[model samples]
Target: MCSVTLRPALPADLDALSALEQRCFDSDRLSRRSFKKWIKRQHDGLIVAETPERELAGYALVLLQPGTRLARLYSIAVDPSRRGQKLGEQLMDAAEDYAHEERRLYLRLEVRKDNAGAIALYEKRGYRLFGLTPDYYEDHEDALRYQKRLHYQPADAARLHLPWVQQSTPFTCGPACLLMALAALKKQTPNTTEELLLWREATTIFMTAGHGGCHPMGLAIAAKQRGLSAAVWSNQKGALFVDSVRDPDKKAVICALHEHFVKTCRQESIAVHYQDFTATDLDRAISNGKIVLVLISTWRLDGRKAPHWVAISGSDEECFYIHDPDPGEDQAPLDCQHVPITREKFEQMRKYGQAKLRTAVVLGA
Candidate 1:
C-alpha cells in the first residue's frame, strides 16, 4: 500500500495542481491561472495529497462563503494511477475537516450525472442529493447537486423550513424573497411571471445605477395585495435610499416613489413602524409564525457594496438562517438556502448604504 500526506496547497504546488487537473479531467479542467489564484486566496481552501516521493496524488478545493455558514467542494481529483489507494476519500475527509474547522454548517457540490463512481463516493461520504442542473458541464452533461451537513441541530424542528426561490434577475431579490416567504406561509408555488409582477409592483424604478430595487413599503403593500398580512419596520421614517443617489432627478424620483408607497401603506392600513427591527424582534416574529424579508448590504457576502434582499427562514441560538435569492453562478441553490449567519454578523449586514438604512417586512397569515 502507498502512503500519502495531505496538506494545504502552496504557491509551489501550482504546477503540480495544474498538471493533476489536466491528467484527471479531459474537459472542464482548471487552468494554471485558476490554480494560482485559488492557492493565494485567503478564504478558500485547497488541499493536496502528496506522495512520499513528493509527487501529487490528489487535490480538493473548497470555496467559502464569507458571510454565511456554507462551503462548497468546488473541485476534487485523484491521480489516475493513485485511484485504488483511496486518495479521493482521504481528500474528501480533509476538505470536510477544513470546512468544519472554519465553522461552516454545510458543504455542497455538483457531480456530473453520469459519473457513477463519483456519485457513489459522495453518497458513501453522506452527501445527499438535493437538486439537478441540466447541461451543467461543458460537454452538455447534467449535474447532480449534493450537500452534507457539517453541524446538525437537534432544534431544527423549531425552525421554519421555508421554500427556496432564486431571483430570476439581479434586481428582483426583494421580490424573490417575498415569493419564498409567501410560498412557505400560504403553501403557494412561485413562478417567474409572478416574480416579475411582484417586482413591477414593488420596484422603486431607479436605484444607484440600474433598474430600481423593491422598497420595504412597496413589498409590504404587494404582500397585502396577495392576501397576506404585512408590516414594515424601517429606521428611516421618510424616503429610503435617497441619500445614496447623487443625481438630483433620480433622488427626486426615489422620494416620489417613497411618498407614494407610504401613502399606499396608510390607505391599505399596513402597520408601519419607524424603527429598526432588532434580532430579538426577528426571533419573536419567527416564533409567532411570521416570515421576514430583510434588506442587507452585499458587502459582507460578495464584497459588493449594494443593497440585497433575503428571507429569514429560521434561527437557532447563535445564528439566523437566511434564504438568499441571488446564488451566484459558482454556488448551488442549496448553498443559498437556510444559510446560517451569526447574530453579530447579521447585525452588521442588515443595514445598507452610508446612511446605514435598516428595513424589514414582516408577513403573516
Candidate 2:
C-alpha cells in the first residue's frame, strides 16, 4: 500500500524469502536451498519487494528456459500482510522487464487451476492461459499454464502456406493435423464434420481409458484413401500405446489395431521411413511445396503426456512454425493455433512413448 522498493534478491535474504514463501503458499513452497541457489544464478534469479520499513514484502523468481527464447515465472509469493496491495502485480512487471532484458521472447507461468484470484490477476496483467496440466501439483490438483508475449515481430522465415486451425475433438489431434496437410496440399478446406470423420477413420481403436488418438500410420492410410500421396516416417514398427494401457482387453485391442495398421500400410505400398526426421527434412519438404504432420509430446507446453499431431507449416534457421488444432481454452488465437517454436524445442517435443519414438507423415498432392 505504501512506497515499496523492488530490487534483485541477494544471498542474505534466503531465510527471509523462505519464511515469506511458507506464509504465502500452503504447498509447493520453495526451500531455503532453492532460495540460495536462485539468488546467485544470473539467468535464473529472484527479485524482491521491500516495504517502507525495509522488510521483505514479496519476491518473484524468473527462470530462463534452456534451449528456448522463453522465461518462466517459476514461483512468486508475497507476505500475508502485503495482500490486496498489488505487490504481486508489481513483482510480475519487474520480472517481465528483467526477462525482456535477457532477450527472451515469451514469459510464462503455471498457477493452480482453482486459484481464481491469481488467475484474474495474471489475466489483468496480459497473461493468457494457454493450456492446462492435469494433476500437476503434490495435492493432485491441475495447473493452468499462462503466457505473455514480451515482444511481437513478424518472423523472418518464409512461412509455409497453411490452412484453417481447429481442434475438433479431444482425440482428434492426429486427424486434425493430417487434414490441414491434405487441405493445404489439395488447396481445399475440410469442414468440422469431415474433420471428425477423418478422426474416426484414423483413430488407434484404443487409448489410455478415454477416446483413442490417431496413429501416424492410420493417418497415412487415411491420406492415401483420400487420393493423396503419403508416407510414414517413424521408428515404431509394432504395437504402439500397448504398454500405456493396463487392462488386458485394451492392450490386446491396441496391439491388434497396430498390427492392422501395419498390414494395411504394407499392402498399399506406403513409403515408411523407419528413422527420425530432422528439421532439415521438414524445411526441405515444405520448401518443395509439400505438407508434413509430425508427432509431438506436449511436455513443454503443459507438463502432460499429450501425444499430439501438428502440421509442419514453415521453418527458418531459428524456429519451426506449426499449425496446431487444439491450442486449448483461454488462449489467444495466435497463442493457441499458430505456434512458432525453436527447432531444438520442436526436437525435444516430437518424441513420445517409453522409447521416445520419433514419428511423422509426409504428404503431397
Candidate 3:
C-alpha cells in the first residue's frame, strides 16, 4: 500500500508513462501518437500512480467495450525499480476504480504466459483467467485472457441518513422510483457534514458497479432544498435505444420529470449533467467525486414496473450508501425541509424499478 495518488493520465504525463511502459513490457510499448489518441477518446480511461514528489511510478489504461458489459485493461505497468511495493496493485486498483466508475461489470486483460509475476498479482486480486490466446503477444507467445468481476453488497456499502426516502408519496410512480427520487434528493443537499458523508458513501457504492443516474437528480434536489449547489453524471446504455413509451411511458415520464427538475435547477442556477445513458459518462462524473446515483433495473418481474432507483449517497472502505426511495406513507421523518418524503418505506420502493430501468445521475459542484 504505497501512499500514491491514482489520477487520470494527461498528455503531459506521456513521457513518464511511456518510459514506465518501455521498462515494464517487452513487445508493446505505446508510442507518443498512441498515447495522444488514447487521451482523446472519451471511452478510454488512463490512470497514473504518482509519488508525493509528483513523479510517475506506474500507469494503467482501460477501454470500455460497448454493449459487452466489460472493460479492457489495455495496459498496466509499474517501474521495475519500485516493484513489490504494491504499485501494481495500486495501478490495478485505479483501473478497477475507473471500471467501477464507468459501471463496467468486469475488467478483461491479456497477459503474457511468461509473466508469472503479473499473473500472480492479478490472481491475488481475484482476477480469473478465463481463456488463452495463442500467439497473442509478440514472438508468437501465448497470452492469458483474464477478467475480474466487481460486486457490492448493500450491507458492505455506506450508510445514508435520508429519512425522507422512507416517506410515502401520492405520486403514481412505483416504490423504486420513489426511493430513487429520495436518494437523489439527499445527494443534492450534501452540504451538512453528515449529508456529505452520506453522499460520498452513496456514490462510492455505485462506482463499484460502474453505474450512474437520476438518483443524482434527487440528490441535487435535496441539496437545493438545503441551499447547496451540485451536479451528477451517469453513463449511457450502448446501442440500447430506450423508448420511455414502449415501457408504458414510465421512462418518458421520468425524463420529463428530470427535465423539469433541470429547468428548476436552471432557474435556481444549479449545475447538472445527465451523461447520455452510458456508464462511461457516469464513470467520469463519479471519479471526479461528483455525486453519481445509479439505478439498476431488471425485467424479471416482467417490465411492468418502474426501474429501481438508488442514491449513491456516500462511500467507504468496503461499501457505498444506497439511499432507497420511500413511496409508502408514514416513514422515518427527518428535519431536512428540502426532502419531500419520509424514511420508512424508502427501501421498499427500490424494488419497483428492479424490473426495467437502471438510471444514473451525477450532481455537479
Candidate 4:
C-alpha cells in the first residue's frame, strides 16, 4: 500500500469515477451523468478513495431516505489494482459512517449473489442478507439484498410492535393482514381462526387466481361483525375484484357480494371514506394508536401481479412499518413482519386494482 487517502467526491471527479467503474465491472455500470447527479444531489456526498498522488482508487454513492432513519449504499466501485488492499472495505465503512451521522437507522445494499468476495466482506462488516431479487442485473443475474440495522433514537418509542402470522392459504392474504391488525390493536394474539372466518365473510366470488380476495367493504363488514370498528376508503365504488373475473357467472356472484357489502356497510354505519389514500393518513392513524390493513400489488414484492395485503404497524415521515401477512422467500429473512418501506415507495406500492386504487381500512379498538 502506498499511502492512500479517503475524501468526498467532487464534480471534477465525475469522469474519473466513470473510468474507474469501467475498470472494475463488465456491465451494469453507471454513466458519468449518473455520477455527476449523485455528486450534486446525494445528501451524503459521493465518497471516494485517492492515492497519495491524488489518483482515483475507489468511490461509493450513498442515499439518505427522507422522513425516516434509513439509508442505502446505492453504488460502490474500486480500482482493479487496489482490489486486495481493502479499499472496498474502507469505502464501505466510510459510507456507513456518513449514513449513521445522518441519523439513519439502517444501511442497505444489493449485490450479485455469485460475488462471494463481496458477500463475505459485507457479512464481516455486520451486514445481513435480508432480501433476494430475481434477475436484478442487466445480465439477468440474481441479487442478494443486505441490511445492517443502525442504532438510533429510543428503542421502544421508535418501533410499533405487531403480532405476525403468515397466510395459511394462497388467497387468504387479505384476511390474514386484517387479523394481524385487529390482534395488534386489541393487544392480543389470535390464531388463524379469525383469519379463516374473515375470509369466509369477505372473499369475493372470483379473483385473478383460484379462490378470491377480500373486498375493502367486505373487510369492514367482517370487522364490524366481530365487534370492531372499521372504516373503508376506496378508489372504485362498485365491487372490487369483480372487474378482474373473466367469467360472466363468476362476475355476477362477485357483484352480488359487492352489493351485500355496500348495503351492510350502510346499515352498520361504518363510514366509507373516499380518496387516493396517502401514507400521511396511515401515519396519523398509527400516531393515534390505531391499526391499518392495506392492499398492495405483490408485483413489487415478487415480479407477480397478485393481490396482497399488509398490516400497517408504525409510521414516520420517511417510512411505513408493515406487518406483511404473506412474506415470501425473499421477505422472510428480511423480517417482513416489521419491514420499513420508504414513504414514497409505500405510497406507490399501495396502488393496486385496475383503477390504481390506493385504499386502506383502519381497524379501531
Candidate 5:
C-alpha cells in the first residue's frame, strides 16, 4: 500500500491536479478555464496526496452550494497505477472528512449511471441514491444523484432538520404522543420467560416489517437491559417518514442513537444492516461478531411519525425481539424492553413501511 500524505492544494499543484483529472476522466474534460472556476468557488476546497518524492498520486475537488448544507464532489481522480490500491477510497475519505468538519449536513455527488465501480464504492460508503438527472453531463449522459449523511448522532440529525430541537421550541404534543407510542410497545412487552418469547416474536414482526424497526436496535436494547454494552454501525441518515409537526431529518438522527450506543458499549455485540444499505462500511466497523439491525420503517404512511425505530435481537423458533423506539419515553424501560411480533406480521408490516426510507446498523470494525 502506498502511504500518501494528505495536504491542502496550492497554485503550483494545479497543474498536477488538472493532469490527474484529464487522465482519469473522458468526454467531460475540465479545461484550464474550468479549473480556475473551481478555484474561485468559495465554500469549496481542493486536496491532494503526494509520495515522498512529491508526486501527485490522487486529488479531490469539492464545491459548496448556497442555502443547502451540501458539498458537491466536483472531481476526484487517482493515478491509473494506483487505481486498485484503494486510493479513491482515501480521497473520498479525505474529502468527506473535510466537508463534515466544516459542518456540512450532507455530501452530494453525481456519478455516471454506468460507472459501476464508482457506484459500488460510493454505495459501500453509505451514499444513498436519491434520483437521477437526465442529460446532466456535457455529453448528455444521465447522472446518478446520491446523498451521504454526515451527522453521526440522532440529536445532530434532529437538530439539523428541526432546529427547534436545539432552539427549545417545546414539544407541545406532551405525554399523549409518548403514551400512545409506549402503549404500542406495552401491548407486546414480555414479563415471563414465555412472555418474553411471545413479546420478542411480535416486536420482531413489527420491526422487520417497518422502516427503522430493524433488528439491530432489538439486540442492543436487550443487551442494555441486561447491563451489557451494545454497539451498532449505521449507514443511512434521515428518517424514512416525514412528520408535519417535525422535520423528516429527525428520523435519521433518532436512528443514529443506536450507533452512539454501540460505540459506547464494551461488549463484542451485534451489527445490523440491510441488503441495499451500505454493508461494507458496516462490516469494516464490526470486523466480525456483531448483530445486524434491519431498518424496516419504510412502510409508514405519509405524515405519520414513522414507526421506524426497532432493534432486532436474537431469534429462535419461539420469538425474536425487535427493538422499537415508537414505544415513547413513558414506557421505555430503564434499559429497553424486548417486544415480540410474529414473522407473518413482520413481513406484513414491511409491506406497509416499504414506502418509506430505511437503513441498517452494525458495529464499526
Candidate 6:
C-alpha cells in the first residue's frame, strides 16, 4: 500500500486529471478543456490525490449551484491500481467536506444504475436514493440519483407533514403551494393539470414579466372554491401588485381582478385581515391544525428580486419549515421540501416589492 495526499487540483495537474478521466470512464469522460476550466473555476472544487512520487492516484470534482444550498459530485475517479486502498471513500469524504465548508445543505450525484459497487459505496456513505433518469448516459444507461443531507435535524412528529408539489411553470408557485396545502388537508393527490387549473383560477393576470403571479386574495378564493375554510392576512389594503405594473391597461386589469377577488371573498364569507401575519401567528395556526401559504420575496433564497409563494409546513421555536414550490433546475425536489428558515430571516423574506407587502392565507377544515 502507498500513502497518498489529497490536495486541490492545479493547472499543472490538468494532463494527469484528463488522463485519469479517460482511464476511469469509457463513455462520459470529461474533456481536457473541461478539466482546465474546472481547475481554474472559483465556484467549483477539483481535488486530486497524489502519491509521494508526484503521481496522481485519484481525483474528485464537485460543482456548486449558485442561488441554492446544493453541491453536486460531478465526477470522481480512482486509478485502477489503487482500488483496494479505499481511495474512493477518501474522495467521497473530501467532496462532502468541501460542500459543507461552502455552506451547502445537501450534496447530490448521479451514478449508473448497473454500477453495483458504486451504489453500495454511496449507500454505505449515507447517500439515499431520491430519483432516477432514463438514458442519462451517452451509452444509453439509466442513472440512479442520490442525495445526502449535510445537516440533519430530528424529525418533529407534531409538525404538519404537508405534501410537496413543484410548480409546473415559473409563475404558478402560488397555485402549487395552494395545491400542496389542499392535498395535506383533504388527503387528495395533486397533479400538474390541477396545478394549472388552480393557476388559471388565481392568477392576477399581469406582472413584471411573462404570466402574472397569484395574489393572496385570489389564492384564498381558490382555496374556498375547493371546500376549505380560507382566511387572508395582508398588510396592504389597496389592490396588490398594481404599483408594480407600469402599463395603465395592465394596472387596470390587475385592479379589476383584485376587486373581483375581494368581492368573491366577501360573497363566500371568507375572513380577510388587513395586517401582517407574524411568526407567532404562523406557529399558532400550525399548532391548531391549519395549513398556511405565505408570500415571500425570492431575493433571499435565489438572488432573484421576484415575489414567490411557499407553504408553511411546520414550525419550531427557532425556525419555520417551508415547502418552496420552485426548486430550480440544479436543485433536487427534496432540497426544497420542509426547508427550515430562522424566525429573523423569515421576517425579512416574508415581505415583497417596494411596498414591502406581507401576505398569507390560512386554510382549515
**TM-scores vs. true structure, each candidate:** 0.81, 0.61, 0.42, 0.61, 0.41, 0.77
Q: For candidate 4, list the clashing residue pairs, or say none.
A: 67-318, 69-105
lDDT per residue as tens, model 6, 1-365: 44888889888898888888888888989899888877777434788999999999999889776544567898899999899888899989889999999887668888999999999999998888866768889999999978877776345422636888899898999999988988888977888998899889999989988899998988988898888899999999989987777999999999999999989999999999999898888888998899999999989887888999999888766567788888786566756765757577789888899999999999997
* Model 5: CA > 4 A from native: 37-44, 153-365
> In model 5, what is the error at residue 352, expressed in angstroms?
42
Per residue, candidate 5 scores C-alpha lDDT tens digits across 40-64 of 5532467888988899999887765
lDDT of each: 0.88, 0.79, 0.52, 0.77, 0.50, 0.85
Error of 6 at 119 (Å): 6.3
- Please identify which of the two predictions, 1 or 5, would achieve the higher TM-score against the true structure: 1
- Please identify which of the two predictions, 1 or 4, would achieve the higher lDDT against the true structure: 1
> Residues 1-365, candidate 3, lDDT per residue (tens digit)?
67788888776787887677788777767887777777666334788888998999888888764322346788887888878798888788878988888876567788889989889888998887755668775688898877776654224232333323432332212233333333454443212344343343222122111222224455555555554455544333221113323443544544555556556667766565434344344334445555544544423212334344444554433323344443222222211111211122222222322123334445444
Judging by TM-score against the true structure, name the best candidate: 1
Model 5 is weakest, by summed lDDT over 10 consecutive residues, at: 159-168
In model 4, which regions exceed 4 Å deviation?
1-158
304: Cα error in model 2, Å: 0.8
lDDT ranking from best to worst? 1, 6, 2, 4, 3, 5
Q: Output the lDDT of residue 200, model 1.
A: 95
Once fitted onto the true fold, the runs of candidate 1 whose alpha carbons sit more than 4 angstroms away are 10-37, 40-44, 80-84, 101-103, 110-154, 157-160, 186-191, 247-249, 328-334
- Top lDDT hit: 1
Task: List the candidate 6 regions with Cα displacement exceeding 4 Å.
Answer: 11-37, 65-76, 105-163, 182-190, 284-290, 313-321, 327-343
What RMSD, rounded to one decimal, does every model reach?
3.6, 9.9, 19.7, 9.8, 19.2, 4.1
The worst-scoring run of ten residues by lDDT in candidate 1 lies at 152-161
